[model samples]
Target chain A: MKITCPSFKYWYPRLKSGKLAANDEQLAINHLSTCEKCRKAANAIEALIEDKIQPESDVFFSARLFARLEKSKPSHSVFIFRPVFAYTLLLSLSLFLGIRLGTYFYYQSSIPSENISISEEYAIHSTISGLDVFFQDDFNE
Target chain B: MDENEKFLDKLQSGDQQAFRILVEKYQPMIQAIGIQMFERSEDNEDFIQEVFIKIYHALPNFRRKSSLSTWIYRVALNHALNLNRKNKWKKWLMNGLNLIGSNEQAVPQMPGQIEENAEQREMRRLLNKAIQRLPENQRIAFVMTRIDGLSYAEVAEVMGISEAAVDSLTQRARQNLRKHLSTYYKSL
Candidate 1:
């Protein structure tokens, strides 16, 4: 039986590369000898395979790539709060609060109770005097 | 540790020199991919830079399961495929707009104006178009195997497919390319 074009196509490369078994190689070779179309197709396939585009070369490619990398390198200076830093912050805040509250209470206790009572009495007297003046103004009017 | 692992360690530790060496070593491979994927040299250059940048960002989290080359191939291929898809969409949209806006056809190239090298360039362009028209897996397999000269096993590893699968894909790719080239050649 004659090999179909598709079968020839599939096995042609294998035969060329010597990947096919001897029997398969013989079969492909026999087919190629008789089939003008497959032969032309094979030539075209080889030409296509050989016709690779040359890769353009830049001598300064590495330099430019590195320059770009250097330019675009993300900044590492962003503050990342570590557990230690967080703990230290918490400890400092607690210490500050403790000191502030302690100082407030100590100052509160340090002022004599009699002085506070005197200030309260003065505040009440001042309010009374201000009210009396306001009422006297109304009466005068 | 092996050389790849050591190099990876240095890369992970933010060693710029290691990064330079890595880029120097792999630039050609990445360029090959870029050149295969893009038509314009500038586009290839930009694509290469983008691939390297992606590799740079991805290195820190790399689990070191695959060889660096394989991983790089995977990344380069993925990026090229995505860029190609976007470019195809853009080209289609532009072509549609052109169709609507003007009936004036593009000027044909004069035979006298064609240089000796023009035929080769035209053939290469046609071949690239044929390759681009290939299905994703077949194109990848064919390009990796034929253009980049990767072995079937290596291509399979990069593509995450069995070696036999790569062989089949590449066979199909070659068949398709041959068909396309034959049709083009006959038309001429």
Candidate 2:
């Protein structure tokens, strides 16, 4: 049904098999009437498609697939990818890590910087301010 | 999202009902590919089931950036080709072991084949042999474009090749098959 010669030639099997509907099939036949190249290509591969379509598989085919699914469905994937379980796991993990990190950091900071003695803070600030003044004086000089 | 995207979410999460739907939808396509790709096998149904099982396991790993059916085709074709290659190696090893003659191919006598007349059977056997002898790329191109009823563009998408490349490959595949059949007729 494609416009190109390649497409036409490739579609020969479908045409020969009459799987194409009447209208489309007629159109293909019309085109093939004038197209010796397509006809030649079709004649070459006629043997391949001449075989009857492999019979419709027995009705139990889907049943067998489902039966196999019951036996072969890997459980861990179902459990792990279960939407509710996955979301709950992620949420719980984040909460657990958040609480643990918050507590650990709080404990590590028992001597919080805000708790520095006023006198020590004043001394640290004075030293920093003095260094800034020194750097300014050097730049100016 | 589209129907397939929604269905894909379920498939990726290992939803059984969704998997069943997928099996129903794709088994026919895979079956067609199997018929076109190799000689009839006793385990043809099993091969399709194996493809489904592989698709199930591989869903998580499959990226959805492109069309899912294209990916499925690629998976089906790749699996079929790999199985064919392995079978060839096995057949060769059997031959090497002096278990079978060179001309004595493993022309499987499946149920459908049982009904074929001798002339039809001979034609099928010759076609199968010639197709199997085609270079891998040509064989894939031939199966997809010629037998599977996929357009060259569709095959290109599945194969990750340019449409021009697909066209060339298909032309070459047809030419090679023509040569193969011609040689046989010439022998007669």
| Candidate number with greatest DockQ | 1
What TM-score, computed on C-alpha atoms, does each candidate reach?
0.62, 0.60
> lDDT (0-100) at residue B125 of candidate 2?
68
Return the lDDT, model 1, position B65. Answer: 89
Model 1 DockQ (Cα-based): 0.10
C-alpha lDDT of residue B187 in model 1 = 28
Off by over 4 Å in 2: A1-58, A73-141, B101-115, B186-188
How close to the true structure is residue B72 of candidate 1, measured as C-alpha lDDT?
91
Q: Each model's interface RMSD (Å)?
A: 7.1, 7.6
Q: What does the TM-score come to for chain B in model 2?
A: 0.86
Q: Tell me the spans in candidate 1 whose CA falls farther than 4 Å from its real position.
A: A1-44, A50-58, A75-141, B99-116
Best by lDDT: 1
What digit string (tens of lDDT, one per residue) describes model 2 on residues B57-109? 89999888778889888888888888888888987898889887557444544
lDDT of 1 at B184: 56
Clashing pairs in 2: none
lDDT of 2 by residue, A13-108 (tens): 456545677777877787777877665555645646333344234456778877887799656767867888899999999999999899667656
